[model samples]
Target: MRTLAAIVLICTATAPQAHPHIFIDTGLTAIVDDAGALQAVKVTWAYDAFYSLLITEDYGLDPDGNAVLTPDEEAQLRGFDMQWIEGFDGDLVARLDGGSLELSRPRDVTLVMREGRLVTTHVRDVAGTPAMAGHILSMKPFDPTYYTSYDVTMNVRVQGLEGCAIVRNLPDLDAGMQQLQGALTKLGRDQDAIEEGFPEVGEAFATEVEITCADR
Candidate 1:
Protein backbone atom coordinates (compact mmCIF):
# COMPACT_ATOMS: atom_id res chain seq x y z
CA MET A 1 0.00 0.00 0.00
CA ARG A 2 1.18 3.51 -0.81
CA THR A 3 0.86 5.52 2.37
CA LEU A 4 0.55 9.29 2.50
CA ALA A 5 3.35 9.50 5.03
CA ALA A 6 5.75 7.73 2.71
CA ILE A 7 4.79 9.93 -0.24
CA VAL A 8 5.13 13.06 1.87
CA LEU A 9 8.54 12.04 3.10
CA ILE A 10 9.72 11.28 -0.39
CA CYS A 11 8.41 14.54 -1.78
CA THR A 12 9.72 16.58 1.12
CA ALA A 13 13.16 15.12 0.71
CA THR A 14 13.21 15.33 -3.07
CA ALA A 15 11.18 18.38 -4.06
CA PRO A 16 10.45 20.37 -0.89
CA GLN A 17 7.43 21.95 -2.58
CA ALA A 18 4.25 22.66 -0.64
CA HIS A 19 1.25 20.48 -1.38
CA PRO A 20 0.83 18.41 -4.59
CA HIS A 21 3.72 16.15 -3.70
CA ILE A 22 3.15 14.09 -6.83
CA PHE A 23 1.80 14.72 -10.31
CA ILE A 24 0.05 12.38 -12.69
CA ASP A 25 -1.02 12.84 -16.28
CA THR A 26 -4.42 11.24 -16.45
CA GLY A 27 -6.58 9.74 -19.21
CA LEU A 28 -10.20 8.62 -19.02
CA THR A 29 -12.40 6.65 -21.41
CA ALA A 30 -16.10 6.27 -20.77
CA ILE A 31 -17.56 3.00 -21.98
CA VAL A 32 -21.13 2.74 -23.19
CA ASP A 33 -23.30 -0.13 -24.27
CA ASP A 34 -25.19 -0.43 -27.57
CA ALA A 35 -28.14 1.31 -25.99
CA GLY A 36 -25.89 4.29 -25.18
CA ALA A 37 -25.91 3.44 -21.50
CA LEU A 38 -22.75 4.11 -19.50
CA GLN A 39 -21.10 0.89 -18.43
CA ALA A 40 -17.54 1.57 -17.30
CA VAL A 41 -14.64 3.92 -17.40
CA LYS A 42 -11.02 3.15 -18.15
CA VAL A 43 -8.53 5.33 -16.34
CA THR A 44 -4.86 5.75 -17.12
CA TRP A 45 -2.25 7.46 -15.03
CA ALA A 46 1.31 8.33 -15.98
CA TYR A 47 3.41 9.34 -13.02
CA ASP A 48 5.94 12.12 -13.20
CA ALA A 49 9.48 11.02 -13.75
CA PHE A 50 10.66 11.97 -10.28
CA TYR A 51 7.86 10.15 -8.51
CA SER A 52 8.33 7.19 -10.82
CA LEU A 53 11.96 7.01 -9.85
CA LEU A 54 11.05 7.02 -6.18
CA ILE A 55 8.55 4.21 -6.68
CA THR A 56 11.06 2.17 -8.61
CA GLU A 57 13.66 2.68 -5.94
CA ASP A 58 11.30 1.96 -3.11
CA TYR A 59 10.23 -1.29 -4.71
CA GLY A 60 13.86 -2.21 -5.42
CA LEU A 61 12.95 -2.77 -9.05
CA ASP A 62 14.94 -1.63 -12.07
CA PRO A 63 18.26 -2.11 -10.35
CA ASP A 64 19.96 -1.40 -13.62
CA GLY A 65 18.35 2.03 -13.61
CA ASN A 66 17.49 1.46 -17.26
CA ALA A 67 13.76 1.72 -16.50
CA VAL A 68 13.24 -1.70 -17.99
CA LEU A 69 11.69 -4.38 -15.81
CA THR A 70 11.88 -8.11 -16.33
CA PRO A 71 8.72 -10.13 -16.62
CA ASP A 72 9.00 -11.21 -12.98
CA GLU A 73 9.67 -7.65 -11.92
CA GLU A 74 6.69 -6.50 -13.93
CA ALA A 75 4.49 -9.02 -12.18
CA GLN A 76 5.72 -7.78 -8.83
CA LEU A 77 5.05 -4.20 -9.80
CA ARG A 78 1.49 -4.87 -10.88
CA GLY A 79 -1.23 -3.31 -8.75
CA PHE A 80 1.31 -1.33 -6.72
CA ASP A 81 -1.03 1.62 -6.66
CA MET A 82 -4.38 -0.14 -6.42
CA GLN A 83 -4.09 -1.24 -2.83
CA TRP A 84 -6.70 1.19 -1.72
CA ILE A 85 -7.31 1.65 1.98
CA GLU A 86 -10.86 1.76 3.25
CA GLY A 87 -12.78 4.87 2.23
CA PHE A 88 -10.34 5.76 -0.52
CA ASP A 89 -12.23 6.74 -3.66
CA GLY A 90 -9.44 5.98 -6.14
CA ASP A 91 -9.23 9.69 -6.90
CA LEU A 92 -12.16 9.61 -9.31
CA VAL A 93 -15.49 11.42 -9.13
CA ALA A 94 -18.31 10.69 -11.54
CA ARG A 95 -21.65 12.39 -11.39
CA LEU A 96 -24.86 12.57 -13.34
CA ASP A 97 -27.68 15.06 -12.82
CA GLY A 98 -25.95 16.40 -9.71
CA GLY A 99 -25.96 12.97 -8.10
CA SER A 100 -22.86 10.91 -7.45
CA LEU A 101 -22.40 7.76 -9.48
CA GLU A 102 -21.05 4.72 -7.70
CA LEU A 103 -18.07 3.02 -9.32
CA SER A 104 -16.69 -0.38 -8.62
CA ARG A 105 -13.14 -0.95 -7.47
CA PRO A 106 -10.38 -0.91 -10.04
CA ARG A 107 -10.01 -3.97 -12.23
CA ASP A 108 -8.21 -4.98 -15.43
CA VAL A 109 -5.17 -3.20 -14.06
CA THR A 110 -1.99 -2.95 -16.10
CA LEU A 111 1.29 -1.33 -15.16
CA VAL A 112 4.42 -0.76 -17.17
CA MET A 113 7.48 1.41 -17.38
CA ARG A 114 7.37 3.71 -20.35
CA GLU A 115 10.12 6.20 -21.09
CA GLY A 116 11.26 6.08 -17.45
CA ARG A 117 7.77 6.80 -16.12
CA LEU A 118 5.38 4.45 -14.40
CA VAL A 119 2.19 4.26 -16.43
CA THR A 120 -0.79 2.32 -15.16
CA THR A 121 -4.32 1.68 -16.39
CA HIS A 122 -7.40 0.38 -14.66
CA VAL A 123 -11.09 -0.10 -15.33
CA ARG A 124 -13.89 0.91 -13.00
CA ASP A 125 -17.34 -0.40 -13.82
CA VAL A 126 -20.29 1.81 -13.15
CA ALA A 127 -22.80 0.39 -10.71
CA GLY A 128 -25.84 0.79 -12.96
CA THR A 129 -26.29 1.31 -16.65
CA PRO A 130 -27.33 4.90 -16.97
CA ALA A 131 -28.49 6.04 -20.37
CA MET A 132 -26.59 9.03 -21.71
CA ALA A 133 -28.93 10.23 -24.41
CA GLY A 134 -30.39 13.14 -22.53
CA HIS A 135 -28.20 13.41 -19.44
CA ILE A 136 -24.76 14.88 -18.89
CA LEU A 137 -22.04 12.94 -17.14
CA SER A 138 -19.13 14.63 -15.44
CA MET A 139 -15.92 13.02 -14.26
CA LYS A 140 -12.83 14.27 -12.53
CA PRO A 141 -9.72 12.79 -10.98
CA PHE A 142 -8.18 14.39 -7.93
CA ASP A 143 -6.87 13.79 -4.45
CA PRO A 144 -9.01 15.66 -1.95
CA THR A 145 -6.15 16.65 0.33
CA TYR A 146 -4.15 18.01 -2.61
CA TYR A 147 -1.30 15.70 -1.78
CA THR A 148 -1.25 14.63 -5.42
CA SER A 149 -2.32 16.58 -8.45
CA TYR A 150 -3.95 14.91 -11.42
CA ASP A 151 -4.16 16.53 -14.84
CA VAL A 152 -6.23 15.12 -17.63
CA THR A 153 -3.49 15.59 -20.15
CA MET A 154 -4.15 12.47 -22.15
CA ASN A 155 -7.13 11.33 -24.14
CA VAL A 156 -10.74 11.55 -22.98
CA ARG A 157 -13.14 9.59 -25.11
CA VAL A 158 -16.39 7.67 -25.11
CA GLN A 159 -16.53 4.19 -26.60
CA GLY A 160 -19.45 2.34 -28.13
CA LEU A 161 -21.57 5.46 -28.24
CA GLU A 162 -22.43 7.63 -31.20
CA GLY A 163 -23.09 11.34 -31.24
CA CYS A 164 -21.53 11.71 -27.82
CA ALA A 165 -19.24 14.64 -27.35
CA ILE A 166 -16.58 14.97 -24.69
CA VAL A 167 -15.59 18.30 -23.34
CA ARG A 168 -12.63 19.07 -21.08
CA ASN A 169 -13.18 21.78 -18.56
CA LEU A 170 -10.01 23.35 -17.32
CA PRO A 171 -9.91 24.51 -13.74
CA ASP A 172 -9.51 28.13 -12.84
CA LEU A 173 -6.06 28.04 -11.33
CA ASP A 174 -6.16 31.62 -10.08
CA ALA A 175 -9.34 30.99 -8.17
CA GLY A 176 -8.11 27.68 -6.90
CA MET A 177 -4.91 29.26 -5.65
CA GLN A 178 -6.84 31.97 -3.94
CA GLN A 179 -9.01 29.42 -2.20
CA LEU A 180 -5.95 27.47 -1.03
CA GLN A 181 -4.29 30.58 0.26
CA GLY A 182 -7.41 31.54 2.14
CA ALA A 183 -7.57 28.13 3.76
CA LEU A 184 -3.92 28.28 4.65
CA THR A 185 -4.32 31.71 6.19
CA LYS A 186 -6.98 30.35 8.48
CA LEU A 187 -4.45 27.80 9.73
CA GLY A 188 -1.87 30.48 10.61
CA ARG A 189 1.86 30.36 9.84
CA ASP A 190 2.96 28.63 13.01
CA GLN A 191 0.52 25.76 12.61
CA ASP A 192 1.42 22.65 10.67
CA ALA A 193 -1.07 22.48 7.83
CA ILE A 194 -1.21 18.71 7.78
CA GLU A 195 -1.53 18.31 11.50
CA GLU A 196 -4.11 21.07 11.59
CA GLY A 197 -6.02 19.16 8.93
CA PHE A 198 -5.42 20.58 5.52
CA PRO A 199 -8.60 21.48 3.71
CA GLU A 200 -9.94 19.21 0.97
CA VAL A 201 -9.86 21.59 -1.96
CA GLY A 202 -8.43 19.46 -4.72
CA GLU A 203 -11.62 19.57 -6.75
CA ALA A 204 -11.20 23.30 -6.99
CA PHE A 205 -8.07 22.72 -9.08
CA ALA A 206 -9.15 19.63 -10.99
CA THR A 207 -9.98 19.36 -14.68
CA GLU A 208 -13.47 18.01 -15.21
CA VAL A 209 -14.56 16.04 -18.26
CA GLU A 210 -18.16 16.23 -19.35
CA ILE A 211 -19.84 13.81 -21.73
CA THR A 212 -23.10 14.43 -23.50
CA CYS A 213 -24.89 12.61 -26.26
CA ALA A 214 -27.36 13.86 -28.80
CA ASP A 215 -30.81 12.34 -28.82
CA ARG A 216 -30.93 9.08 -30.72
Candidate 2:
Protein backbone atom coordinates (compact mmCIF):
# COMPACT_ATOMS: atom_id res chain seq x y z
CA MET A 1 0.00 0.00 0.00
CA ARG A 2 1.22 3.51 -0.75
CA THR A 3 1.81 5.99 2.04
CA LEU A 4 -0.19 9.21 2.36
CA ALA A 5 2.88 11.27 1.66
CA ALA A 6 3.60 9.28 -1.43
CA ILE A 7 0.07 9.75 -2.68
CA VAL A 8 0.39 13.48 -2.17
CA LEU A 9 3.65 13.54 -4.03
CA ILE A 10 2.20 11.65 -6.95
CA CYS A 11 -0.82 13.91 -7.19
CA THR A 12 1.21 17.07 -6.93
CA ALA A 13 3.84 15.91 -9.37
CA THR A 14 1.29 14.82 -11.90
CA ALA A 15 -0.97 17.79 -11.26
CA PRO A 16 -3.80 17.86 -13.81
CA GLN A 17 -3.16 14.25 -14.78
CA ALA A 18 -3.90 12.60 -11.43
CA HIS A 19 -4.58 8.91 -11.73
CA PRO A 20 -5.11 6.09 -9.30
CA HIS A 21 -2.06 4.01 -8.42
CA ILE A 22 -4.15 1.15 -7.03
CA PHE A 23 -7.38 -0.31 -8.34
CA ILE A 24 -9.78 -2.64 -6.58
CA ASP A 25 -12.92 -4.47 -7.56
CA THR A 26 -15.34 -4.14 -4.68
CA GLY A 27 -18.36 -6.18 -3.53
CA LEU A 28 -20.83 -5.57 -0.75
CA THR A 29 -23.33 -7.75 1.06
CA ALA A 30 -25.69 -5.97 3.38
CA ILE A 31 -26.78 -8.11 6.28
CA VAL A 32 -30.20 -7.59 7.79
CA ASP A 33 -31.77 -8.87 10.97
CA ASP A 34 -35.07 -10.75 11.22
CA ALA A 35 -36.65 -7.45 12.17
CA GLY A 36 -35.77 -5.96 8.77
CA ALA A 37 -32.93 -3.86 10.15
CA LEU A 38 -29.39 -3.70 8.87
CA GLN A 39 -26.94 -5.54 11.11
CA ALA A 40 -23.70 -5.69 9.17
CA VAL A 41 -22.00 -5.41 5.82
CA LYS A 42 -19.54 -7.79 4.23
CA VAL A 43 -17.00 -6.15 1.94
CA THR A 44 -14.87 -7.93 -0.59
CA TRP A 45 -11.92 -6.44 -2.43
CA ALA A 46 -10.05 -7.99 -5.34
CA TYR A 47 -6.86 -6.12 -6.04
CA ASP A 48 -5.43 -5.68 -9.51
CA ALA A 49 -2.59 -7.88 -10.65
CA PHE A 50 0.09 -5.22 -10.32
CA TYR A 51 -0.83 -4.31 -6.76
CA SER A 52 -1.28 -7.99 -5.87
CA LEU A 53 2.20 -8.72 -7.12
CA LEU A 54 3.56 -5.87 -5.05
CA ILE A 55 1.85 -7.18 -1.93
CA THR A 56 3.03 -10.72 -2.53
CA GLU A 57 6.59 -9.55 -3.01
CA ASP A 58 6.45 -7.15 -0.05
CA TYR A 59 5.31 -9.95 2.25
CA GLY A 60 7.87 -12.37 0.83
CA LEU A 61 5.09 -14.75 -0.11
CA ASP A 62 4.76 -16.84 -3.24
CA PRO A 63 8.52 -17.37 -3.36
CA ASP A 64 7.95 -19.82 -6.17
CA GLY A 65 5.91 -17.19 -8.08
CA ASN A 66 3.07 -19.58 -8.76
CA ALA A 67 0.55 -17.26 -7.10
CA VAL A 68 -0.25 -19.96 -4.57
CA LEU A 69 -0.01 -19.33 -0.87
CA THR A 70 0.61 -21.98 1.74
CA PRO A 71 -1.38 -22.15 4.95
CA ASP A 72 1.34 -20.29 6.82
CA GLU A 73 1.60 -17.69 4.07
CA GLU A 74 -2.13 -17.15 4.10
CA ALA A 75 -2.07 -16.79 7.87
CA GLN A 76 0.63 -14.15 7.59
CA LEU A 77 -1.26 -12.33 4.85
CA ARG A 78 -4.51 -12.16 6.77
CA GLY A 79 -5.22 -8.79 8.29
CA PHE A 80 -2.22 -7.31 6.50
CA ASP A 81 -4.35 -4.51 5.14
CA MET A 82 -6.29 -4.00 8.35
CA GLN A 83 -3.58 -1.98 10.02
CA TRP A 84 -5.29 1.30 9.25
CA ILE A 85 -4.16 4.63 10.58
CA GLU A 86 -6.39 6.82 12.70
CA GLY A 87 -9.47 8.39 11.02
CA PHE A 88 -9.41 5.85 8.24
CA ASP A 89 -12.91 4.59 7.43
CA GLY A 90 -11.75 1.53 5.51
CA ASP A 91 -12.88 3.35 2.35
CA LEU A 92 -16.51 2.54 3.10
CA VAL A 93 -19.27 4.92 4.02
CA ALA A 94 -22.77 3.96 5.06
CA ARG A 95 -25.58 6.42 5.49
CA LEU A 96 -29.17 6.20 6.64
CA ASP A 97 -31.63 9.01 6.08
CA GLY A 98 -28.75 11.26 5.04
CA GLY A 99 -26.87 10.66 8.28
CA SER A 100 -23.75 8.61 8.76
CA LEU A 101 -24.06 5.09 10.12
CA GLU A 102 -21.41 3.91 12.51
CA LEU A 103 -19.69 0.71 11.53
CA SER A 104 -17.58 -1.50 13.75
CA ARG A 105 -13.99 -2.38 12.93
CA PRO A 106 -13.55 -5.13 10.41
CA ARG A 107 -13.80 -8.71 11.68
CA ASP A 108 -13.80 -12.16 10.17
CA VAL A 109 -11.11 -11.19 7.68
CA THR A 110 -10.19 -13.67 4.98
CA LEU A 111 -7.49 -13.44 2.35
CA VAL A 112 -6.61 -15.48 -0.70
CA MET A 113 -5.08 -15.25 -4.14
CA ARG A 114 -7.65 -15.64 -6.90
CA GLU A 115 -6.53 -15.81 -10.52
CA GLY A 116 -3.30 -13.98 -9.69
CA ARG A 117 -5.12 -11.26 -7.77
CA LEU A 118 -5.25 -10.72 -4.04
CA VAL A 119 -8.82 -11.04 -2.80
CA THR A 120 -9.91 -10.27 0.73
CA THR A 121 -13.19 -10.08 2.60
CA HIS A 122 -14.21 -8.71 5.97
CA VAL A 123 -17.38 -8.06 7.92
CA ARG A 124 -18.21 -4.76 9.57
CA ASP A 125 -21.10 -4.84 12.01
CA VAL A 126 -23.35 -1.86 12.20
CA ALA A 127 -23.07 -0.13 15.53
CA GLY A 128 -26.84 -0.39 15.94
CA THR A 129 -29.60 -1.91 13.95
CA PRO A 130 -31.13 0.61 11.56
CA ALA A 131 -34.61 -0.23 10.35
CA MET A 132 -34.75 -0.51 6.61
CA ALA A 133 -38.42 -0.02 5.81
CA GLY A 134 -38.73 3.57 6.88
CA HIS A 135 -35.34 4.86 5.85
CA ILE A 136 -32.99 4.85 2.90
CA LEU A 137 -29.70 3.04 3.21
CA SER A 138 -26.83 4.18 1.02
CA MET A 139 -23.31 2.87 0.75
CA LYS A 140 -20.19 3.90 -1.12
CA PRO A 141 -16.70 2.43 -1.09
CA PHE A 142 -14.11 5.02 -2.06
CA ASP A 143 -10.72 6.53 -1.33
CA PRO A 144 -11.17 10.24 -0.73
CA THR A 145 -7.64 11.01 -1.89
CA TYR A 146 -8.19 9.32 -5.28
CA TYR A 147 -4.93 7.37 -4.94
CA THR A 148 -6.94 4.17 -4.78
CA SER A 149 -9.88 3.57 -7.09
CA TYR A 150 -12.74 1.24 -6.15
CA ASP A 151 -15.10 -0.31 -8.68
CA VAL A 152 -18.29 -1.89 -7.37
CA THR A 153 -18.44 -4.56 -10.01
CA MET A 154 -19.33 -7.61 -7.90
CA ASN A 155 -22.53 -8.96 -6.46
CA VAL A 156 -24.53 -6.72 -4.17
CA ARG A 157 -27.13 -8.46 -2.05
CA VAL A 158 -29.32 -7.81 0.96
CA GLN A 159 -29.64 -10.83 3.18
CA GLY A 160 -32.54 -11.60 5.55
CA LEU A 161 -34.65 -8.83 4.08
CA GLU A 162 -37.60 -9.22 1.79
CA GLY A 163 -38.93 -6.61 -0.64
CA CYS A 164 -35.71 -4.69 -0.50
CA ALA A 165 -34.12 -3.69 -3.78
CA ILE A 166 -30.64 -2.40 -4.42
CA VAL A 167 -30.11 0.52 -6.78
CA ARG A 168 -26.76 1.44 -8.27
CA ASN A 169 -25.93 4.95 -9.46
CA LEU A 170 -22.73 5.19 -11.42
CA PRO A 171 -20.84 8.44 -11.65
CA ASP A 172 -20.76 10.49 -14.80
CA LEU A 173 -17.17 10.18 -15.90
CA ASP A 174 -17.30 13.08 -18.36
CA ALA A 175 -18.54 15.46 -15.73
CA GLY A 176 -16.30 14.03 -13.08
CA MET A 177 -13.27 14.41 -15.30
CA GLN A 178 -14.13 18.00 -16.02
CA GLN A 179 -14.53 18.65 -12.31
CA LEU A 180 -11.20 17.02 -11.56
CA GLN A 181 -9.46 19.09 -14.20
CA GLY A 182 -10.90 22.30 -12.82
CA ALA A 183 -9.85 21.37 -9.32
CA LEU A 184 -6.38 20.50 -10.48
CA THR A 185 -6.07 23.79 -12.28
CA LYS A 186 -6.94 25.62 -9.08
CA LEU A 187 -4.49 23.51 -7.11
CA GLY A 188 -1.75 24.21 -9.62
CA ARG A 189 -2.10 27.91 -8.95
CA ASP A 190 -1.58 27.37 -5.25
CA GLN A 191 2.00 26.57 -4.35
CA ASP A 192 0.84 24.91 -1.12
CA ALA A 193 -1.54 22.45 -2.75
CA ILE A 194 0.76 19.58 -1.90
CA GLU A 195 1.11 20.64 1.69
CA GLU A 196 -2.56 21.59 1.91
CA GLY A 197 -4.14 18.57 0.25
CA PHE A 198 -5.27 16.99 -2.98
CA PRO A 199 -8.89 17.52 -3.91
CA GLU A 200 -11.12 14.71 -2.66
CA VAL A 201 -12.51 13.61 -6.01
CA GLY A 202 -12.93 9.94 -5.28
CA GLU A 203 -16.56 10.36 -4.36
CA ALA A 204 -17.09 12.02 -7.69
CA PHE A 205 -16.11 8.79 -9.40
CA ALA A 206 -17.75 6.35 -6.97
CA THR A 207 -20.76 4.18 -7.56
CA GLU A 208 -23.44 4.63 -4.95
CA VAL A 209 -25.66 1.75 -3.80
CA GLU A 210 -28.99 2.43 -2.22
CA ILE A 211 -31.37 0.01 -0.56
CA THR A 212 -35.09 0.60 -0.52
CA CYS A 213 -37.50 -1.62 1.34
CA ALA A 214 -41.23 -1.98 1.01
CA ASP A 215 -43.36 -1.39 4.07
CA ARG A 216 -44.90 -4.41 5.68
- Best-matching candidate per TM-score: 1
Off by over 4 Å in 2: 1-17, 186-196
**Model 1 worst lDDT run, 10 consecutive residues:** 1-10
Q: How accurate is candidate 2 locally (lDDT)?
A: 0.82
**Model 2 per-residue lDDT tens digits across residues 1-216:** 223324434654657445567888899998988888889999999998889999999989999998878878888999988888888999999999889999988999999888888899999999878888867889999988776888888899888888878899988766766666667778554345447676788788788999888876
Name the TM-score of candidate 2: 0.87
Q: Which lDDT values do the candidates have, in the order given?
A: 0.83, 0.82
Candidate 1 lDDT by residue in tens digits, 133-160: 8789999899997878888889999899
Q: Rate residue 103 of model 1 by lDDT.
A: 95
